[model samples]
Target: MRVMAFDYGTKRIGIAVTDPLQIIATGLDNIHPNNIIEFIKKYLQTELVERFIVGEPKQMDNTPSQSAQHVKGFVNLLKKTFPEMPIEMVDERFTSKMASATIAQSGMNKKNRQNKELVDTISAVILLQSWMDRRLL
Candidate 1:
C-alpha cells in the first residue's frame, strides 16, 4: 500500500507519495489550494493510496500554530471526501527548514531552490519520510 502526504498552506499544497512498499517518499507536486481535492481525485485514478499523512504545523512550544485551524478544516474535508482512507497528522515544526537545507545540499540551482513550490514539495517529502521512519521503529 502507498501513503500520500501533504504540506498544507493557504495558497499552495505540497504533495508527496510513497512507493507501494512504503520505503521511499518522493516529491509529487505543489498544487493550488483550490485544486487540491480535484488533483488528488485525478491522481487516485491511477494510484492506490492507503493513507494520508498531513503536516501538523505547531509553534516552538508545541502549541498548534495559527495555520493549524486551516489544516483542521482541510482535514475535515478530506475525511468527508475519502471516508475509507485513514488520515494521520505528523508534527512539522522544522520540515521547511530541513527542506531548504536538503535542497541546498543537493546542488540544485539557486533559482530553482528559491521557488516556494519546490520547497513545499520537498517539505511534504520530509514529512512523509519522517512518518515512515517512525512507523518502522
Candidate 2:
C-alpha cells in the first residue's frame, strides 16, 4: 500500500505520496488548511493510502517548536477523519533549509525557489523519505 506524508502549516499543508510499493516519495501538492481534508478525501478515491507520516517540528535543542502545537492539532483532526489509518510523527528539523538548498541545486528559478508552497511540498517529500529510510534499517 502507498503511504502519504504531510508538512502541516496553519495556512497551507504540503502533501507527498509514496509509490504503491512504498519506496519512492514524490511531492504532490499544497492545499489550504481548510481544504486539506477534502483534498485527501478526493485523493483517497484514487489511491489506497496505508498510513500517514506527519512532520513534527522540533527545536535544535530537541524541544517541541511553537509550530509543533499546531501540528498536533492537525494530527488530531487527521486521526478523527481517518481513524483507521496509522499516523506517525517524524522530527522535522532543518527540513525547510534543506528544501531551499535542494530547490537551489535543482536549478529552479528564483521565483520558484522562493515559493513557500514549493518548499513545503519538498519538505514533505524529505520527511517521508527520511521515515522510509529509517524503516528499511
Candidate 3:
C-alpha cells in the first residue's frame, strides 16, 4: 500500500502520493479545498493508500501557526470520513519555501516558476518525502 499527503491551505490543497512500496513521493494534484474528499474517494477506487499525511504548519518557534486551526478542522473531517485510515502530521514550516527554491533550480521558465499551484504540489511531495525519511530513522 502507498502513503498520501496534503499540503493544506485555505485556497487550494496540494496532494502527493507514494508508490505502493512507499519509496518515492510524487506530486499528485492541486485542487480546491472543497474538492479534496471527493477527489480522495475517487482516487481510492484505484489505489491502496495505507496512510495519510498532512503538513502541519508551524511558527518559527514551533507553535502551531494561525492556520493550524484550519488544518485541525480538516483533519477532524478526514477522521470522520475515513476512520479506518491512519493520518499523520509533520512539520511543514519550510516546505513551501523549499519548493520555491527547488523550482527555481529546475530550469523551468519564469512563468512556471510563478505557479503557486505547482509550488503547492511540490511542497506536498517534500512533506511526504520527509515523513518517509523519518520512518527510516
Q: Which candidate wins on lDDT?
A: 3
- TM of each candidate vs. truth: 0.97, 0.98, 0.99
Backbone-clash count (model 2): 0
lDDT tens per residue, model 3, 19-123:
999999999999998999999999999999999999999999999999999999999989999999999999999999999999999999999999999999999
Ranking by lDDT: 3, 1, 2
Identify the runs in model 1 with alpha carbons over 4 angstroms from their true place.
Answer: none
Give the alpha carbon lDDT tens digit for every residue of 11-82 in model 2: 888899999998799999999999999999999999999999999999989999999889999999999999
- The top-ranked prediction according to TM-score is 3
Candidate 1 structure quality by residue, lDDT tens digits, 12-85 = 99999999999899999999989999999999999999999999999999999999999999999999999999
Candidate 3 accuracy as TM-score? 0.99
C-alpha local distance difference test of each model: 0.96, 0.94, 0.97
What's model 2's overall lDDT?
Answer: 0.94
Cα deviation at 103, candidate 3, in Å, is 0.2
> Model 1 reaches what TM-score against the true structure?
0.97
Give the worst 10-residue stretch by lDDT in candidate 3: 28-37
